[model samples]
Target: MKRPVPRIDLFDVRPDDERAFVFAQDLRIIEARLFSSAEPQTSTTLRPHLSAKADVGALMEALQRDYAPRGVNLLRVAGGWMLCTAPDLAPVLNEQAPEQRKLSRAAVEVLAIIAYHQPVTRAEIEDIRGVSTSKGTLDVLLETGWIRLRGRRRTPGRPVTYGTTPAFLVQFGLDSVQDLPGLDELKGAGLLDGRIPAGFSIPLPSDDPQLHEDEEPVEPEPLDFTLSPLPTADEDEN
Candidate 1:
């Protein structure tokens, strides 16, 4: 029997609707990985970025409204809004996101200190960590969405202060630091050990006299962001 004539595969560069749709999904996931690798943007960073961009805009808007009452914030980034935690809780979110990325323990600690102690200088984070932070560590965190430069402190040498972004909150899935797990859970720091250190004096929201305890504090309720209505695909900027 003669073999069937070989046919060349068609070279159709134009994507069909289904191919385009699946391709779009693949792109989104790739973008997520890229963004995640960039820096510590947020703890619960993945879903929020996905929802707020491109196709799912409308769904995101609805989610914000649903999650807002629980103290979630659907923040509009300079480019567009993404779900973020309340400003005050930046430090806690960073702390909770340890090991989620390639960050070193020292780097995560520094990021937390900056988020909580914003407008603070490198000297300050070192004081808290009881170790000097490498510039690359801060650079990594900055590249990620977790922290940013606030401004120079009004002091001699005018050291730069760092702060957390709305993106940071989103990545960490926190509404506010007040919602951070109680002292019991933090001390149970499986990866890192001990309390905020003996001499560190960052202001805390706890009423308990002993803010730092032997055991880790109980973990707070995970952030519950209420989604909000956003533009439809027709109105999407992308």
Candidate 2:
């Protein structure tokens, strides 16, 4: 359901450099909380006050126009302003954090396609992957809020199309699809193969035997084919 944008105290942004990033991150946390809220309150410090009376437009200008030039990227979504680094610099952080776990090749490709040609259909995805995706695969991404439906495509059947979610960018430390690694970069890094790193398959644990001990055994049906003639109407009735 659509809700009112909580008034954020725009003036709360501290006058500092490194703290800008912290404030930017904190601003998103506040927005996420506000977006998910029902009875939005004004008592919240960061909801929507700015410079003792500056309007939101002026605040955005101050944040996105001026501060962003100094290396911040302010994005307005869901009636809230979020502070983050420009998409241009996202790769630098990812490069620096080499220890961060990489997603499976299949998952990465799925994400990449969604990032590039968003609102794409499952058929299109299968064509791109050259293999049918498990039904649960997309479910996993959706459950993690990495992707979401972007309405249906106006095709023959109007299948629901998929697109990346904001959480996806946050998780990857990216500002947008524009921050995605270039084709040449992926190729140079030998990542085109899209192989998942070793041993990520999580095998399920066995259920408790106690739960099934009293359950009925499923009997395997015996084959009864002996070149029998098709049942006549009389025999069928009998």
Number of the top-ranking candidate, with TM-score as the measure: 2
| True-structure lDDT of candidate 2 | 0.56
- Candidate 2 residue-wise lDDT, 73-162, digit = tens: 566532345555577787767766667444667777776677666656788888977998766777767877788776666557656677
Backbone clashes counted, model 2? 10
| Cα lDDT tens digits for candidate 1, 61-130 | 4344544765545653423344456667777687676564677878878876765555457888888778
Model 1 TM-score relative to the real fold: 0.42
Query: What are the lDDT scores of the predictions, listed in order?
Result: 0.55, 0.56
Global lDDT for candidate 1?
A: 0.55
